[model samples]
Target: MASSRPKNAPFLFPTFNSSVLPDPSRFFSHDLLSAPLPTNSFFQNFTLKNGDQAEYFHPYIIKSSESSISISYPSLSHNSAFIYEAFNADITISGSDEPDQHSRKTHLISSFSDLGVTLDFPSSNLRFFLVRGSPFVTCSVSSGNSSIKISTIHAVLSFTGNSSSTKYTAKLNNNQTWLIYASSPINLVNDGGSSINCGGGFSGIIRIAVLPDSNPDFESILDRFSCCYPISGDADFTKPFALEYKWEK
Candidate 1:
């Protein structure tokens, strides 16, 4: 299948190697490479890294040939009001060759208290290895007590399979089912620890906001964060990205 390439960005994708890719006949059903992507939403494009070795703000899941992991982010728009409430969020991340087996699962949902905000990935199959090319949201519960954490992360997809959408079904704590979508066609590739795409060059930058005029320990607050820098604009800095809570009422 021929890939309709995007205009090259400043950075470029790594050289493609047919040797490491899986055979088409064994893993494909259709030509997903020509499938259309959802408009406005950027595709997650990058390689997976081990959790301990990844930099802060760049969270990811270990790749597994047997099973693909699924993630559901809070549904909100880029201009939606930022989260300012005190609620917890949970994330369930996992990866494996066989998701049905209990033994292959290695990750689970992690609870972040006081904030009611957690990013859960099942601890049974994969580890959280965050990287750049993604941005996380933050919130202020009250004066003197604010929290900043990852709310979203994305990467380009690559795999050894026949034509497929690369989506998987998983249930939430409420027993609700959601589809985890992969950045199909693998439009990007990993290069020197960064996500490089055909649209441009390597830009492993994730946007973040610092509380406005609220004199606090900025460095300490962002200790786990790296490669973060300020983006100048007239908009209020207190409000960074949009958010929605999944906590119980």
Candidate 2:
């Protein structure tokens, strides 16, 4: 005879172990880029336009957690040189059991994540993550018969400490070298009561140029970020720069 179970009797089945399942959080907690070196890191100090001082660290690390991508710095109280802007993209999931659930979601993105590059300073125990956002550099390239213009962002990580040199260099992928020069005077007072100029800027005016040796057509590179950074009238790509940093003084 078949056994009859009570209406509220607990169903007996094989014990499923959730430990064997893949952890979704682990996927987000991984490092996006890392290059370990000695503890002797290189850093520079700069005064903000509002009269506040901050330190910039080179050879930094980029790590992503469940919520945001963090650019690790030596000091937690350091001020950011440039404005930090967060972007969002809409993601649609097609194959979902429920029509309302998982239909769409907004994903947060970093402006510098797409064009970020890592560089190592020779003889220094540091690796710098060079990245930037809006106020993009518009490049005018001459093709066979037409001129193509592309807007992209790049960062000036450090300067070649030459007393007589004013040009700052940034090396990108495929052996591309970018030149950065101060368009305006950068005056900052350090803690030592000395005025410093002609170094790096936490937030100052500078000009950028792409060498002819590097690839002028950044269409392929920009295509990779089409979803995150759409070229629309309201998008950051259309603006020269956005100042999100507020100073009290």
Candidate 3:
């Protein structure tokens, strides 16, 4: 009898050696060679206690700075109303590869760290830093309030359909879900005698929040999220490049 599996079918379990992995630097631009690569992160829409909601569509980058972690929305327009509403929060991950026999799953632990916000407008070549307060996520600009403490917790990332049209969630260890909302943008003043509207390119803001475990109407809130970013490719995973790997015992 002949095997029924398709010749093009992906391996049930694919493994690769370190040498087989592509260099990360090749994905970055030449000018950025001197700079550190950005961490690709995602956010979704979140609702407030007052029935207010904010939406996010495109992926953002989280860059580490000397004093804080800067979250940049590279696709948003500089004039977007939700610019200032983007703030920053600390994120610490702790987990091992070992899986739990009972749950049959490996968990990723996440915790809060001291954080601040930085907004970058590449088109306008402008940058802003917020050290006071955020409209969404609860965080402090200073060393962070020691009185308010969020215990070490675990989070899970939930994917919906396609990668671009998916929801990236951070569920707490107690099974509570949190949200990071980016509200409307605020007016910018010409402090440096430069026109604030000089740049017509995309703008990036940093604002986020974690919803309380009390639970809000997530079903309705998620519906309000609109995708502002453009989808270039089909709704399927890209085909992998042809490569051969030798399995070792």
| Candidate 1 minimal-lDDT segment of 10 residues | 139-148
Candidate 3 has an lDDT of 0.28
Tens-place lDDT per residue, model 3, 182-205, is: 222222212222111111112232
Q: What lDDT does each candidate get? A: 0.26, 0.27, 0.28
Give the higher-lDDT candidate: 1 or 2.
2
The root-mean-square deviation over C-alpha atoms between each candidate and the true structure, in angstroms, is 22.1, 22.1, 21.7
Candidate 1 lDDT, tens digit per residue, 164-226? 522222223333222222323212222322122222211122222222222334433443442
Ranking by lDDT: 3, 2, 1
Summing lDDT over every window of 10 consecutive residues in candidate 2, give the lowest-scoring window.
88-97
The parts of candidate 2 lying over 4 Å away from their true place are 1-165, 185-203, 214-249
